[model samples]
Structure formats: C-alpha cells, structure tokens
Target: MGNDGGSIPDRRDLVRTKAKAEQADKANQTRARWFFCALSKRRLEEPIVACPLGRLFNKDALLEFLLDRASYGADGAAVAGHIRSLKDVKELKLTANPATKGKGKGRGEGENEETPKFVCPLTFKEMNGAQPFAYLAPCGCVFSLSGLKSLSSAKEKEPGKEGSTTPEKDEEQLELCPQCGAKYSKSTDIIPLNPSPDDESLLRARMEAKRAAEPKKSKKRKAADPESSDPPKKKKSSPTAAPTVNPNIAATSRAVVTSLALEEAKRKAGMSDAVKSLYGDPSKPKQKETFTTMGTFTRYA
Candidate 1:
C-alpha cells in the first residue's frame, strides 16, 4: 500500500515501538533488582549485635574467642565481622533457623518472610542489636540506651534533665517502646541505661521506713528494798495452854523432870566454875533461863 498521510503505521514501526518498550521494561527491572540486592546485601553485612538476633549468637563467645572484646561494642568493623560469621554459620546450616517462616499468600512468600522469636522487650524492634542490649542493625530496628533513663522517667511521670528535678509534665514525656509501646516506671529495675534518682529515693525511703518500724529500748526502773519485795511474809503461832494429866502420870513426869533439871544444873555449875576461875570473879550474876511453865514439887522426909 502506498503511503497515505493519515493511514495506520507499518509493521516495522510497530516492531520498533515494541522493542523500545521491552528495553524500558528491562531497564526498570534491572534497577529494581540492583536496589533490592543492595538493600539485602547491606542488611546481611550489618552487625548481628546491632540486631536482635545478636542476643542468640552469644556476644561474649564471639568477642572473647572470635572477635576482639574491646572492639565489640559500637565498632563497625567488629560488628561486620560478627555478622559475617553469623551468615556463614546460617548458610552452612550450622545454626538452625531461629525464626519460623510465617504463612504467606504464596508458596515462596512464606519462605521469603521469616519472623524472629524472642523480640526485644525494650525496642520491640526486630531484636537486632548486640546481645543483652538491643542496638540498631542496618535492618533498621534497634534497642538503644540513649535517653533510656529519660524515657523511663517519662513513663513514670517524672521526666527531668540529667540532674533536674522537673516532674514529668505529662505522659508524653516518656519514651514508649517502639514495638509494643509499653510504658515503664522510672527505676533501675525497669531500665538499665543509668541510675535514676527515683530509684535512689525509693531505696532511701525504704531504709528510713524500716528504721522507723524497728522496736525501741525502754528505760530502766530504780531498784526496790529486798525486805519490801512483793513476796508474802510468814506469821508466828501463839503458845498453847499446858494439858491436864493423871496423878500417876504427872508424878512420874515430875520425877523425870527433876532428874533432868539436876543434871542440867550440874553442867551449868561446872561451866560457871571454869569461867570464874579464868576471870577470877566468883560472885558474877548467873544467867537465868526463862521458864514457859511451872510444876508442883513433892518433898520426901
């Protein structure tokens, strides 16, 4: 067909247009692939300690034996080396998959997207960071100590400067967990960043309260006389009247009493004579025994 000015384009023109479109599409695909590869490669190269997975990898083990301990924290080189070690172990299947693959819309999607176990409690980020403490991995999630005390104080409603005493003006002052966004009270028990004044104050208050609760010693009382002590006193019994006796029995008793009195008088006389001889005084008044009763005496011719 001859070239009609407004007619449909020839087969060659259509072919050219299709070719250019395909080239453009191929370029876009290449760009996207490079972008994804760079991003993935960067993530793979990032320090494991900076990622939540670092907690599982054993930082001390890696540091003491594998990497330098002094250079472990905040060291880009050490972090990179640690990450490479992890990648090698994972690729070799030395370390089993710590995370379970989540279900996806398609078969490959599940394998591509795996969710990690044991998320960071502080950051709620992908648990990427150094072990024990979360740090930002190149993967974007991190556990940070920066502003941790401030963050905690904010949650406790006591936000202030490093040493300032300003109470938390509002709840917004505290830093919420980036993951679960849970709030914590200001204390060392919650956050390990730095010592909080609230914790110190609480400790001091507890000590004071304990001291106040303790029992006190009482003052001593004066001693009292032994005679006037609380124990009861004994009473003396009065003398009883002499009993009446039969004539025979009275007579016999009188005879026995007379003999006993005579013997006793002899003993007293001897002792008195000895005492008089020693002192050279014979007429001294003799000691008398007081009598409780008197009996009738009988005389024989």
Candidate 2:
C-alpha cells in the first residue's frame, strides 16, 4: 500500500529553508533591538555603544530621533554625536529632507498655521519664546506696532493745539503756493510783495523818468572817406605817335606769342638728337629745294 504521509525533504533542502527563516528572524530581532535600545536609554550620553559580543549599535535610530532628543533638553553636541553614529551604522542615512529638516513639523501639520517656537525670524536660531527685535531693513528704524501708532497720534494733536492761539500766523501756514501745494517749511524761499494796485500809474511814471535820464548810444558812420578814394582816372595823352596796336590788345598778343614759342621749343627738345640733326637748325631759316615729278605713257613691249 502507498504511504499515507507525504515524503520528507532531503537534508540539503531542509537545511536551506531553515537557514533562510532563521536569517529573516535574526534581521527582525536586530531591528527590534535597535528600537528598544533607542527608547530605553533616552538619557544615555554615549553616541555609539558596544554590545557584549562586540557588535556596534547606534544609540539613535533616526535623525528625527536625535532632533526630538535635542528639543527635549538634550545638548546639541550630544544629539549631533548620536546622529553621526546612526550614519555610521549604514542603516540610517545622514541626509537632508527639506520637508523634515529645520522648523517644519512634518506631514500632519496644517499649512496656514504659524511655525512653532523652534524657528526664529531674526537669526533663524531655534528658541522656545518670543524672539528679540532685530532691524532687517536699511531704514535703521525699529519699533513695534503699538509704538508706531502712538507716535502718529501725538503728531496730529500737536498742530491743532498750537494753531488756535496764533490765528493770523496759522492762516499763513495754510496759504500754499498755487504752483506747489506742499506746506511751506522753514527752508522755503520767500519773495517780497509787489506794491499795491493804487500806485500802479506812479510806478510806471517813475520807470519812464528813469529811462529818459539814461544816455543814448551814438550812431555809427556809413559813408567812405573822400581823400583816400580811387575812382576811374583818365590816361594822359602822349606827345609821341600813338602805337598802331591798342596797348591792351598789344599786351594780350605778346602773351600768346610767348606761349606758342615755349610749346615749339618743348616739342623740338623731345626729338632724338639724330632726328633733330636731320631737320636742321630750328632757330634759323633754311633754304627749301623743290622736286618735280614727270608723267609718261608706256606700252607693254
């Protein structure tokens, strides 16, 4: 008959399964031990401690654990040391999550609510109470909201009380220039008033009399001097016979002859010496010899 019980596994398979389960259990216990150690020794100052078998353990489980410890009266140096130990364990990473770090109160907090006392505006230094006043702008003025309101009320009350006793002078303060409606300060420049309209005619007459008393400038001469004049003069007649050529015409003809003579001389100089010798002397006259041509009729012989 077939066996009623299922067949048992070989030793190797059984040992492998047992080893995996034990490893999982050991990992779970290690995590539990770390958590328990963190919670139990809340007041321990050591950042890392050795167990009996020489295994190292992190005194802090996470960054938040260290931060909470710091907030609840632990010294900053102690908290920082524990955080460094947790990083050495390799199970906890030392990193910044902008969401969890700083004054942020992590996931469950309301968005619009004010941050807790751990955050300060002036230095961003964590604190547990009202922060001290620190000036943050170039104006250098520092005052709480209540102080500013008191100053404004005092200024408004001062002008009214002082104006009633000197009504005439107060009216002048209200008389702003039409061009610039700003209130006149002590630094404003004041011009003297013009005379009243009743004396307008007298003022005009005095101005006219002043103008008549002033000397007038002399007029400048426009005509030329008579002695130094050089108008068209008549040429004197000569006792000798007048030249056939008018003097002006003769002068123009001489200029033309000079230019022609210079151009001919230049042309002769430009010729080769051999070619110039063939043409004979240019400055003196040369006799001309004529050559005659004969015409004849010829028959093919």
What does the lDDT read for residue 126 in candidate 1? Answer: 38
Which whole-number lDDT from 0 to 100 does residue 118 have in model 2? 22
Candidate no. 2 TM-score: 0.16
Give candidates' CA RMSD values in order: 30.3, 36.5
- For candidate 1, write residues 1-301 as lDDT tens digits: 3557777788998899999999999755433322121112222222222211222233334434345545444443433333434322211011112343233334364453333323444444332222233322222233445434345545456443433534544332443445445443322113221113564355446434533454221111112222234221211111121222355578889999999889656645755564434333445323212122111111110
lDDT of 2 by residue, 1-301 (tens): 1344676667888799999999989755543432223334332223433221112234553444455655434534332333333322222111122333544655455541232222222233322113221111112122222333343345345766564646445434533221224333211112111112443344345434533443221111112222123221112223222453466578788888888778657756775664354343454223111111111101110
Per-prediction count of colliding residue pairs? 12, 0
Look at candidate 1 and tell me the lDDT of residue 9.
82
Off by over 4 Å in 2: 1-6, 32-301
True-vs-predicted CA distance for residue 185, candidate 2, Å: 75
Clashing pairs in 2: none
Measured on C-alpha atoms, candidate 2 has an lDDT of 0.35
lDDT of 2 at 21: 99
